[model samples]
Target: MIIAAYNAQDTLVRAVNSALGQQVPVEVLIIDDASSDDTPRVAEGLTRLHDNVRLIVSAENGGPSVARNRGLAEAQGEWIAILDADDAFLPGRLQRMTGVARRHEADLVADNLLFFDWQAQAVAGRALRLADDHVQQVGAADFVGQCMTGRSPFDYGQLKPIFRRRFLHARGLRYPPHLRHGEDFAFVLDWLLAGARFMLMGEGLYLFTQRIGSISSDSSGQSRTILNLQAMRDHTLGLLARPRIRADRALAGLLSKRADAIRDQAIWNRAYPHLRARRPGALLMEMLRDRRSWPMLARHLVRRHRARMLAR
Candidate 1:
């Protein structure tokens, strides 16, 4: 199990404990990304408390991608699993996922997720609603289609997957360090492009915590979020240019749609602050730079109007 932690002092223990409690034996690797908080100390404590737990402190602060890549390099496990510092694994998650992978002869396997609202201290909803016996084989087009932004608030990118270490090593596949956001989606996309056999299980075995201030739950208007979206868009455009991607018409079309959605989302993020401050000049400038912003702003206005009507 690989956990990339930064400023996760309070929740690190819970995540590590869940990994240790897994039905299948796991070697827990906690990579502390030069956190300013007491996360290193907490990780150290876990290393000393559990024989299977180990800690690695980065020399400099890198995002989750860098930290996870470091863990991947040092991991000795045959099957690799990722556990978010703030989230956890349900009992038997790794055991069950690995069983499915072996049965399907898959290079990568992902199960459904149960969203746990931290403030409410309860399970909110599930990531997928498929029947327990349902298992889907995900292809490149299918994966890209599900990840289109604005089409869904949550996407398949949120699914935590377990990968065969040999497949990753053989393909030299690692998370892109430049992307602090959507790195998981990029990584899985690369795996699929490299001919990975990806399988999805319907059972919700992973606990995804929805808490305020978490990286995944941050507001889209933030400057960092905008930059991340821009990076994802550029990355997707590059993928679309690839000969393999270009040859597959359906996959190319889906990727093009995903890139366009990402571009529009970035434009919306750029214009949202000005719209909120009622700065018509700045908003007009943004719309002029990207005409897509007009329709996006109009959609926001329509939603706000509906919300006001309901309140009245």
Candidate 2:
């Protein structure tokens, strides 16, 4: 298991313990990304306590992608699993996921997530509904289509996958370091495109923690988020331009739509400050500058209005 940690002193132990508590024997590699807090100290403690746990500290802070890539490079496991610093695995998660992987001959496997609200200290809900206890094969087109912006509250990209290490090493697969956000989606998209036999299980074994100031929820980092979205948009376009992607008509169409959606999101992020400040003139100017964002803005307004109406 590879965990990329940054300033995760408060929750690192819980996450590491969960991995160690698994029924099967597992090696945990914690990559500390130059944490400003005592995360490295905590990770060091874990390393000392558990012989199977190792700590790899980076000299500089390069975000999760860089840390995860470093862990991937040093990982010796046949199957590689990613665990977030603040999140954890439920009991038997690895054993069950690996079982499904071996039974289906899958290169990558992901299970449904159990959303945990940190503040509430309770389970919020399940990420996906498991209609039946069966594994589903995820096609490249289907995966890309589900990732469309505003398609759902839960993103398919959020699924943390356990991958066959040999398959990744053979294809030289690694997270895109340029993207602080959406890197998982990009990596998984690339994996699927590379002919990975991706399988999704209905079991919710991963605990996905929802923290108020987390990267995805924090609005103060809007500019950084916009840059990430732009990078993702460019990445999608690059994929669409590939001969293999273009040959798959369904996948190509979805990729094109995803690119447009990402562009719209970046534009919306740019305009959000004006909207929040209640500066109609500034918001109008921003909208006029990027007329392509109008459809997305309209959809947003409609959704808000419907939500308000339903509240009544």
The 0-to-1 C-alpha lDDT of every candidate, in the order given, reads 0.83, 0.82
TM-score of 2: 0.84
- Residue-by-residue lDDT tens digits, candidate 2, 1-312: 999988888889999999998998899999988888899999999899999999999999898889899999999999999998888899999999999999999999999987665655555567676853768999888798788875444569889999999999999999998778888898998898889999999988998885332222223211112137777778888887889987888888988898888877887888867876789999999989988767767776775454334323
Which pairs of residues collide in model 1? Answer: none
Candidate 1 on 53-104: residue-level lDDT in tens?
9999999988888999999999999999999898889889999999898899
- Model 2's alpha-carbon lDDT is 0.82
Error of 2 at 196 (Å): 1.2
Cα RMSD (Å) per model?
Answer: 4.8, 4.2
TM-score of each: 0.84, 0.84
Which pairs clash in model 2?
none
